[model samples]
Target: MKTTLQRIGMILFMTGFVFSVCAQEMEVTGTVYDAHDKSPLVGVTVQVKGTQNGTVTDVNGRYRIKVEKGNTLSFSYIGYLVQEIKVNKLHLDVYLKPDKVALEEVVVVAFGTQKKNAVAGSVMRVADQSYYLPSVIFPYPREVNTEEYEAFKENRFLSTIQHPLSTFSLDVDGASYSNIRRMINQGQMPSKDVVRVEEIVNYFSYDYPQPSDGYPVRIVTETAVCPWNKKHNMVHIGVKAKEIPSETLPVSNFVFLLDVSGSMFSANKLPLVKASMKLLVNNLRPKDQVAIVTYAGAAGEVLPSTSASDKQKIMEALDNLQAGGSTAGGAGIQLAYKIAEKNLVKGGNNRVILCTDGDFNVGVSSLTELESLIESKRKSGVFLTVLGYGMGNYKDNKLQTLAQKGNGNHAYIDNLQEANKVLVNEFGGTMYAVAKDVKLQVEFNPNFVNAYRLIGYESRLLNDEDFNDDTKDAGELGAGHTVTALYEIVPVGVDVPVGNVDKLKYQQTKNDVSLPKFADSKELLTVKLRYKEPDKDVSRKLEVPVLANRMNLNASQDFNFAMAAAMFGQLLRNSDFKGDAEYSDVIRLARKGLGNDPNGYRHEFIRLVEAVEQLEK
Candidate 1:
C-alpha cells in the first residue's frame, strides 16, 4: 500500500509539473487609448478574458499583466466598447472607442443639468472631480437582481453590467424636471448614469469663512426676472468659501443616522460603514458630542447624544451597532432629528450627521415626501449633513434632496482618506455653519457678453423673488470652504440670445451706453449675497461688483479653476453649449491655470480625467 501510494504521488507530481511547464506565463503589456481621439487611456481594465487576473492602466495608459499564454486578454471599461485579444504579443496598444450614442454621453454639470452632447475638458492638477462611494459600487449579493442572482449561482459571470433602468433612481430626481419626467413617465429611463445627484451635489465646496473674499468663502448673488413666472423674480446666488482655516473650532452635536438594513450586510456595505465611522470617531475632539442612530427593520437611538469628550462611550456606541433587517430610514431620521433638537446647544453647533447607504425603502419612501420632511425640520436651527455609505440599492437622489433642503453639505465618503478630509481636517467647517440661507444672483450687462450659462448648480437656482424672501431657504456656508461657479460667456460679436422680448425700435441698444455713461463698465455684473449668521433670524445682504477686468479667464486663478471645473462638468453632462470642448483641450487649459498644488486635489483631477478617458474608450 505504501509503494502504491508513493507511485500515485509521484505520478500526480509529474503530471502537475508537465502541466505547469506546458502553460507558460504570458507577459501582457499594453497602452490604452481613446478610440475617438487616439489619446492615451488611463485606468482601463486589462484582464485575462476568463479568469479574475486583471490589471488597470496607469495614468499614462500603460498596463502590464502576467497570464497563461493561451488565455485571452479582455480590455473593458465603462463608456467604451470592450475589446478582447489573445495573449500572443508582449506589447499591445488597445484603442477603445467612445460610445458616442451610448447613454453614457451625459455629464452632471453646473446646477445638475444632465445634458447630453455637452463638450468640456478635464481640469488639471485636480483630484477626482466626481467619485461614487465604494459602497455604491460593490453591492452585496442579496441586493443583486434576478438575472444577477442566476449569474451568481453560476459563479462565472463577469462584471454585472449596470443598466440605466436598474439604477435609474440613483440619477437626478427623474420626476423633478420636465424632460426627465417625460422620460420616466414613458418608462424609457436612460440606461447610462450621466448625471448622478450625489456627484453633482458634492462637486462644489460651499461658501465658508463668514467675512472673507480672498478665498471662495463669500456668497455672490444677483436678481433677474423669472422666465417661468414673470410675475416672480429669480434670485441667483453663488456660494464661495473664503479660505481654508487653521483652527480647533467649536463643540458639535452629531447624530449619526446610519442604515444597517439587510442591503448593507455585505463586507463592503455595513462592515465598511463601521470601519469608516471609526476613522471619523477617532478624529473627534473631546469638546464635540457624538450620538448613534441605527435603523433597519426598526429604528432606535442606540446611543444618546454623548460628548466627544467621552471617547470610550462614543466608541462603544459605534462598536455595539450592527447591521440587519429592512431600512426604516424615515423613522430613523425623525428619531435622529429629535435627538438633535433635544440636545440642541444654543450657539454651539447642532447638526445631524446622517451616515447611510441611502437605500430608504420603508417609511416615507417617496423622495419628495422625504425632502418636504427635511425642509420643515431645518427651521429648527439644527443643520443636517449627509455622509453616504454602502452601495447596491443606494439612493443617492433621495439623500441629495434631503441634504439640499435641510440646508447642509453633502459628501460621498468613498474611502478613509475622504472621511479624514471631511471629518478631521475640515471638522469645524463641516460641522458648523457660519452663514445660513446663503443665496447669490448675478446680473450681467448685455453689452460685455452676448450670452452666458452658469455651469452646474442647476437644481440650486432660485427664483428672482426668492432673494428678498428670507423665508425662502437656500444653502449654508461652512467655515473656510470654497465654492466655485463658471459662466461660459459669448463675446460681444457672438450671436447669443439677447433677451427674448420683442425687438422694439424704441428700446435703446448700442446707443444706451452713452446714455448710461456714468455706469462703470466694472459693474457689468452686480453680485448680491444674502445670509443670516448661524444663530440669527434676520438675514444680511452683501454686495460686490464684478468688473469687466475680473472676467480675464486666462489671468485669474479663480476664473481659471472655475472655468476648468465648469467645462469638466459640462463635458460630463454633454451640454448643448459646451462648445468645441475636448478632454485634451480642457486638460491643457487647466494645467496652465492650476497655479499651485497645495492640496494635491488638482493633481488628482488630472489623474481622474485620464482615468475617465480610459474608461470612455
Candidate 2:
C-alpha cells in the first residue's frame, strides 16, 4: 500500500512538470525601433529563430508572437543589422543599427555627389525637371539610360451605326497603379505613357454576386450618368470568377525564376523580392513543390524541384543569392520553363514566377524576342507571372508584353505591403487560373445608342474575327478574380454630334435590317464571353443581355466606386473626353462608395487621388 501511494505521488510530480513546460510556451510581445533616432520601424520581420512562424511589425513598431521561454527571436529589416535575442520574459524591445557599409554609398544627383547621411537636408533635381529626396537611399538613381515606355493611342469613340461590335480580352493586371504610386511617392507625376487606365481600374476589388449556376464566371452590369460627361451614360460591366477554397486547389509546381543581375542590386529589388518570396514559401502547403532558377550574365538553377515541406532548404537557397553581372532574361526564361516542364504536375498548377526589374540588355533581350519565346512556351501548360521591382530603369513595357503573351498576370511590387497584398492576401487568385483565353464581345443596339467607347482596355482590344478563333490566345481569369470594364454611351435621343462617314456606294443600305426592333425594348446590349477550362483546348461560351434600366450614381456601391475609379484613370491620362470631371469630384464619390474596406485598398485609392490633386496644383 505504501509503494502504490508513492507511484501516485510520482505521477503527480511528472504531471506538474509537464504542465510547467507547456505554460512556458506563451505569447511574446516586442517593439522594434531604429537605433539612431529611436523611431518606430514598420515592416521589420520578426520571427522565432529556426521556425516558420513569423510576423511583421505594425506601424507603431509593435509585434506579438508565440514562442517558448528559451526560444530565440530574430528581428530583421532592410538596410539594418539583424538582431536576435533569447526570450526569458514576454516583453522585449530591440533597436537595430543601420548597416554603415550600405548607408555610406554616394548619393548621385545630376550635378554632384552628397554623403548618404547628408541627404536628409538636400534636394536633387534631374534633367527631366523632376525633384527627388536623396534621403531614400535604397532605390538610388541608375547609371543607365532613362527608362522608356511604349506609346500607344487611346481608344476613340465609335458611332454605333458604323461599328456595332466591340470585342477585347479581359485584363486583370494591376501593375500600372502600383508603378504610378511609386512615382507619385517620389515627388513626381508618372509619365503619360506609364498610365494604363485599364490597369488602374482593375486594381480595386468590386462587390459582385457569385455565379449561381455551374458556370465558372458571372456577369454583372449597371448604367449610370457619366461623371465626366453628364450628357452621356456610363455602363459598368463586372466579371466575377468563382472562388475556390485554397485547400481544394490543385497541387502547385512553381519555379521561382529570379533575376540576380546588377540592376537588381537595389534594396527594393532583390532584398524585397527575397522577403516577399519567403512569405509565399511560408504559406505553401507541403504538397506544393518549388524550384529556384536565377539569371545574370547567364542562367542557372539554384535549387532543384523539392517539396515545400522542406522550407528551410528552399529559404537557404534564396538567401544565398547575390546580385551581379548583366541580365540574360531570355535564357533565364528558357531554362525556367524547361525545369517547369520537367517537373510539371498533371492536372495541377504549373507556373514560372519571374521577379525582375525588367531591364534585359544581354543576348535576345528585345521585347519581340522575349514575347516570341514566352508565347512558344505557354503552350506547354506552364504559366508565367511577371513581378516588376525597383525603379530608375524599370522596363514596364517589356514585362507587360511578356505577361500578356505568356498566359500570366503582371504586378509591380513597390513595397512589402503591396507584396503581402499580391502574394499572401490574394494568393489563390494570383497563383491559380480558373479560366484561360477569356474574351469579351459586346454588341450595342443602334436603335438605343448612337455612339459608344470602351473606357479602358486599349491595349487588350482584339480583332472582331479573333473572338471566335479558338487558336487566338487571350487573358486568363483566376479563381475569385474580379474584372471591371466601363463604356461611355450616347443614347439615341441625346443630341450629340458624331463624326459622319461617306456612304459606301458598293453596298446597299437597309435601315430596317441594320437596326434591331428589339433595341427600343429593355435590351440595351449583349455581352458574349468565351473561355476554356484550364486544361482543355475547347472554349465555352456564355452570353447575357444588359437591360436598358438606368441607375443613379448612388444606386449601388460598386457602381459609384467603379465610376470613381474610371474617372480617376481618365484624369490621370489627361483624357480628351474628360468633360467636367475634376479630382474633387472623384474624392467625393469615392468616399461615399467605400463600403466595408476591410483591406484598406479603397482608402489607399482615396489617398492616391488626394496626392494627385496636390500634384496638379
Highest-TM-score candidate: 2
| Residue-by-residue lDDT tens digits, candidate 2, 1-617 | 99999999999999999878865787888789999999988667777777645656654677777788888887876568778898888899999998765433444443354554565534332223433434333224335435557777788889786789999999999998898876655444565688888898899888888876798899888888887787889888899999999889999999999999988876567867887798789889999999999999999999999999999999899878888999999999999999999999999999999999999988879988988888999899998899999776778889989999999999999877788888888888899999999999999987788889898888899999999999999999988999999999998888644676576688855343674454355678899999999899999999989877656555478778888888887887788887899999999989888998998999989988886675455
Clashes of each: 54, 0
Q: Best lDDT goes to which candidate? A: 2
Give residue 504's error in model 1 in angstroms. 9.4
Q: Report lDDT per candidate.
A: 0.57, 0.83
Clashes of 2: 0
What are the models' TM-scores? 0.64, 0.81
lDDT of 1 at 418: 52
> Could you tell me how far off, in angstroms, the CA of residue 62 lies in candidate 2 after the best superposition?
9.6
Per-residue lDDT of 332-403 in model 1, one digit per residue for the tens? 889988999998877777888787767777888788889888988898878988876533345556766787
The positional error of residue 519 in candidate 1, measured at the CA in angstroms, is 6.0
